[model samples]
Target: MTDPGAYPNPGQHPTPHEQPPRTRRRRWPWLVIGVPVLLFGACGVAVVTSVAGGNDTTVTPGPAAGDTDGGAPDRGPDFPGKLDHDTAAAAGATITRDELAYTVSPLEAVDTVLGSYLCSTVTIDNVGTTQNDFNGYTDWSLQDTGGAIRDATFGPDRPMLNSGQIAPGGRATGSVCFDDRTGATPGTYVVLFEDTFSLSTDRLAWINAL
Candidate 1:
């Protein structure tokens, strides 16, 4: 039998040097994921707003060709030096100029072209004592207002101006025709008659504007 005081000793109680079990702190992982997700969502909203704002602008186009005058017909003055067919020869006395004589009939439009065909009578008078050879075609060209030259083409229906020589104090006459279907615009066109086809002298006789 043991003593009661010795069996249950008070020295067995917790001392000041011993400590209770400490609770470990729980780590909060949601803060790390929530910050990155919020930043990415803000950037996504900004990109969508920028793309939606760009689609509201408008664009325009330019005009087509030949719209310089708003598709309107060219309205200008008639060509000069026009004469009646029957009165052309009778009026020669008044039509005669310095050296050569010319009578241009009014421009005639056979097709959509304003002045498609032009007929004229060219008379060369040898004023000098020597004989003069009057050349044609190569010495003649139709010059437009834009400084473009139109050459001649001989067809079954198209007649070329007769070219020949004239004696002293004598005269020669021939028919002149111009077809402006090709390379012709709505503007003034003049007949240029060069004395010589060579480059030596570019002596020209303008037959007025049409």
Candidate 2:
């Protein structure tokens, strides 16, 4: 307190501990800064994000590239072949084409079955010793309710048919399909078997579907 002329002899700068007070910082500088700019940028980003989301929703339209057009699929060719016959005969021979003779068991149906279309089959026997040589015929004819005469055609083929192997007196039945009428309908069918060797014909059976 008594040092009149005793200032530190030379110019020594103030020590760090005795530095001057700092100027007061203004808080409004932050408010005046880029806050509005940042908010505007955020709004722009949100708009862009929404637009991108909408585009993502419509990324691909309709079906994928390999989608089927729902049109008719390709149909392969129809089968061109004959039917399989139950040729579980004595010899393990499968009867095919003209050589085939088919049969159905005798089935007695009621009036309703007779009135509708049906398939009638009967047993065909192989009676002869040797296998059949040429063709033999079993002619079938029908008399309907209206007195109309219809050929109970063989194999639904042309008139009388040829069978390759109906051994000598062999018997094999062929299918004759037609509607059997009710008793009131009045119908008749006769099956007659004929071969070249036999002058006499063999009458297999007569049936009335009605």
Candidate 3:
């Protein structure tokens, strides 16, 4: 009673093997929006290469400890001849050449009448920037230890490191004498200074003992 041409009724039109399969355009929404935009563009190019390698890191800083040349103030190491008592320069030590600094003080025998004088108390200091000219008799001296050098004299009444001119930061005490006619015992002696007419030959020594 109900077989109207084996089921193709209700205004139908599905012919070609009764089709029903053509749905393949879903590439998971471009892999979920291209894997988070390629992991947020590789974490924004690794945060701009870690902030351009932390602004090209750099530090640099060295020389300073008795500095030299560029910072000048280490005129040590040079004990030429006969300077015992552990390489001279000690009685209140403070050498610094060319730019001048000196500082002796500590060798006071006295005994007058052209004999055991020794004296001391120098000072100098013109840390350098210009004017510098000391000459306690051509820049002090008093070697001994059998090397003989003695030279600084004329201490009219003491206070006399004469031949001045020491501006930049100026300073200049005095008293130098030297002539220790071998009454020996100021720790053998060694208070030289020599910087003659400068071109820098630097000499400074000072172990006239404690």
| Whole-model lDDT values for every prediction | 0.46, 0.37, 0.64
Error of 1 at 194 (Å): 1.5
lDDT of 3 at 92: 61
Which structure among the candidates has the greatest TM-score? 1
Candidate that beats the other on TM-score, 1 or 3, i.e. the better one: 1
Q: Give the TM-score of candidate 2.
A: 0.29
Quick one: best lDDT, which candidate? 3
34 Cα displacement, candidate 3 (Å): 63
Every model: Cα RMSD to truth: 29.0, 31.4, 21.3
Q: What's the candidate order when arranged by decreasing TM-score? A: 1, 2, 3
lDDT of 1 at 190: 58
After superposing candidate 3 on the true structure, give the runs of residues whose Cα lies further than 4 Å from its correct spot: 1-100, 103-123, 126-143, 147-156, 160-168, 183-189, 192-210
Can you write out model 2's per-residue Cα lDDT over 1-210, one digit (the tens) per residue? 769567765767778989888999889879877799899999988866644421111101121112334752211111112112111111111122123243333323323322533234544445335565443333444435465545443333212233555664566544454444433353333222223343223222233334
Candidate 2 or 3, higher TM-score? 2
Q: How many residue pairs clash in each candidate at the backbone level? A: 0, 12, 0
**Tens-digit lDDT string for candidate 1 (1-210):** 878876656668756668777898766677788889999999988877644532221111111111226744221122333221111112122233233444333333333324455444555666656776666566555555676666643322434456777777887665555666654456556554544532223223233434
Return whichever of 2 and 3 wins on lDDT. Answer: 3
Arrange candidates by lDDT, highest first: which order? 3, 1, 2
